[model samples]
Target: MKGLRKITPYVPGEQPNYSDMIKLNTNENPYPPSPKVTEALKNFNPESLKRYSSVDNFELKKALSDKFKLSPEHFLIGNGSDEVLAFCFLAFFNSSDPLLFPEITYGFYKVWADLFHIPFKEIPLKKDFSIDLDDYRQNNGGIILANPNAPTGLFQPLEAIEKLLSENADVIVIVDEAYIDFAGKSAITLLENHPNLIIVRTLSKANSLAGLRVGYAIGNPQYIRIAESIKSSFNPYSVDLLAETLATAAIEDTDYYDKITEKICQTREWFIRELHAVGFDSLPSKTNFVLSTHPKLEISDLYQHLEEQDVFVRYFPTIERLQSYLRISIGTQKEMASVLTIIKDYLSQLR
Candidate 1:
């Protein structure tokens, strides 16, 4: 811990201790995983627990490869997408050149850069909060971005991403698709043409398996081998026996995944309409959350009011441009109804 001064860690969203509050700060699925996941857990053989898990996670990688229509060699699994991203930082970026990303993107990008001692530049988003792709065409060792970016819930088009890849052929371009299942488009399809492209995804969001800690990356065999080296060098058994079993089962159950996604999308649209009716404006969101701001009330005041009513939401303080807005995760219909009611009462009092 003596030389830890160089490390400034990432701060995740708040998980408050108040039991009475309706927790919606983090974008967690309101539903449980498919029954198959439970079955995998219940029927697990205790004898297998004594042995170490498969070093390469062959079974899980193959299941994902089959589901995504890619070769197993192109896949790299990790404890979570965070670990995969960390591996990317170590394997791809160097100290001589730096990484490039949106200034308001996933906070972890900055943290990973600092942790690995890799220099980086934070490109400012345009007035509409969209990335200026031209800014990234300059000098850089690698590029990383959160598709359907966090905190803002905005996404860049694949065409724009392709342009970046086309121009920056020598560097690595990492697309973090943690919320892509909700967004409907994926950059994985582009990996065949761009060997330097890497897409990182997780079972946390759409698959509703955040607790399982399953994440994977898709890229050319060579780039994936780099990640493999980093992972093997650090911890070979990163994905344990139970997690691998559950993740494979979850990936196989396509019907359950589709049904939950459909439901979440439906709820997201309704929440947007209701938010607009209450004098708030929200950006179009392809993710499981909405970012909105009201003209009359301060965001801090609204955040506190919601908490006092036993409903929790997220608020970001560092970005002054977004300090007036709140990021609300789409819960179940019943949970959202409670949030809507609280908003109605609070706004009426303001009048």
Candidate 2:
């Protein structure tokens, strides 16, 4: 036990797989993957599994290259964005100064930093849960900003990001755009002028391929090379064959994803307004989920009641700032309507 690595692991959302439940906890796409992915899976050469997936990740990178207008060398595919971020933390954040991130952002950031023994500083978000860009002006080893940030779903504009990049040109700047498709434009456009910038994305959100576990990073070719070096040292065949085939198919079928994401956005807007009509108000979410709070109801009790009705949502009770809020993922229109009805019935019972 003495030699074992000791660190608190990141706690993921509860995943209870019940057929009849309204599962809007883990932020997965409420819809199925593209037809292209299904077709690719059906036709994928089973024998190819005997061989190791492309160590260079040529095909996956090529697919991303065509989509992002970057060459294959500028991309590095991973088992998920989590793995890609792990590699980035190891490869780039080595300076003596503390790494910087919003205190209320993704929980995994802190876990990865601690696991690697990397010094990190958690800059507090403003009272409204918006990131204070000015707080990141100090010296740091590296920077990571989760656009449309998690839990709160509030997006910081690219102009604010470019300002950070310009000031922090001495260190690496990572813009985690896992939710960017559901929000505004990506910071990938700034890569030409900022070699230190790396944009990490995942198919889990918009592409509806969360099960495939495919994610990639876009940056200057030099950074890509460095991440690839670290990846090869760790797991050369990190991405499997089936994942590559399905991920490639998902990336190419942009139209399907676009349609599904637009539907999700519409549902999120409607859900927020409906919550407001009740006594509950939610953050202006640009992601697939919203963080909401009720004036008179206990969120923990509401979460338990919803689960008893076979509806599941995320509640972060341990985090002091988030204890009163419930982070609900956007589901189908019918499913969301059911959730609303359940809440209304619950409120009526209280009266």
Candidate 3:
């Protein structure tokens, strides 16, 4: 318990055990991963299981580089984007200076800063829940932001990100694009010009590889070297053998990724329109989830009501501003229809 007190863990969305529940809390892809990933797993060699996997993840890096049209030297792979981000904090961020992000952005940013004992300052978002670029231009040792911010499901355009990069040439600018495939643009294009820029991505969202725990980053060779050094020092084989194989297959199958992303985006738009018609004000989302607040229902009460009806969605009760809102992951049409029916009945009961 004494050692445990020193560690504050990140709280992921709830994974409830209710069998009938339409689970939509974690923003996981409603569809299965590509058939290639399944084939890779089934065809895995038992002999390779005895040996340590690639310390450099050469094959996975090459696959990623080829997909992004970047050199293998410009990429680095990790167990998850969280590990890649942890490496960034240790390798690039200095304790003497502060890390900056939006106040109401991803909760993990704050957790990581605390875990590493790094100083940080959170710039508050504007009234509309959008990041103000001027706040980032002022000062900092490094900058990290979720492009399509978590919980809020809002995104800052690539042009705005370019402005931040142009303004802060001295500090490292890390863009956590875990949700970028759902969004319109990616900052990977700026890597050649901006040596200090790092783009972190994960297979969890668009690629449907959350269970595999594969994440990667694209940056200048220098920055990639820093992450590699830290990874080698920490855990050279952080990414397992099977994960590397599956992730490589997943990245190579861009057609599957594109198809799923398009479907998710389409479903998301239809869901938003339906929600609005039912009087729930949902933020325009670029990710697979929607953040919304009902005009009449208390979020807590609604959450409990949904749970009672075997429908699970994410609810953050701690953040006062967001307590009235619920973050709903886009599930299948049938699942969402069930949720809507439950909501319609609940609202009718309230009336």
What do the candidate models score in CA lDDT, each in turn? 0.89, 0.91, 0.88
Residue pairs with backbone overlap in model 3: none
Cα displacement (Å) at residue 231, model 2: 0.4
For model 1, how does the per-residue alpha-carbon lDDT over 1-351 read when each residue is reduced to its tens digit?
A: 585475667888777777667778889888889999999999999899999999999999889888989899999999999998998889999747878999998889999888888899999998988787998888898999899888788888889889989999999999999999885589877887898899999999899998889999999999899989999998889999999999999999999988998898899999999989988999889899999999999889999989888788888888878899899998888888889989999899888
Best by lDDT: 2
Position 230, candidate 2: lDDT: 94
Greater-lDDT candidate between 1 and 3 = 1
lDDT of 1 at 54: 96
TM-scores, one per candidate:
0.97, 0.99, 0.97
Model 1: clashing residue pairs? none
Residue 291 of model 3, lDDT score: 97
The candidate that wins on TM-score is 2
For candidate 2, report its TM-score. Answer: 0.99
The window of 10 residues in a row where model 1 has the poorest summed lDDT is 1-10
Count steric clashes of candidate 3. 0
**Candidate 2 wrong stretches, greater than 4 Å:** none
What C-alpha lDDT does candidate 2 achieve relative to the native structure? 0.91
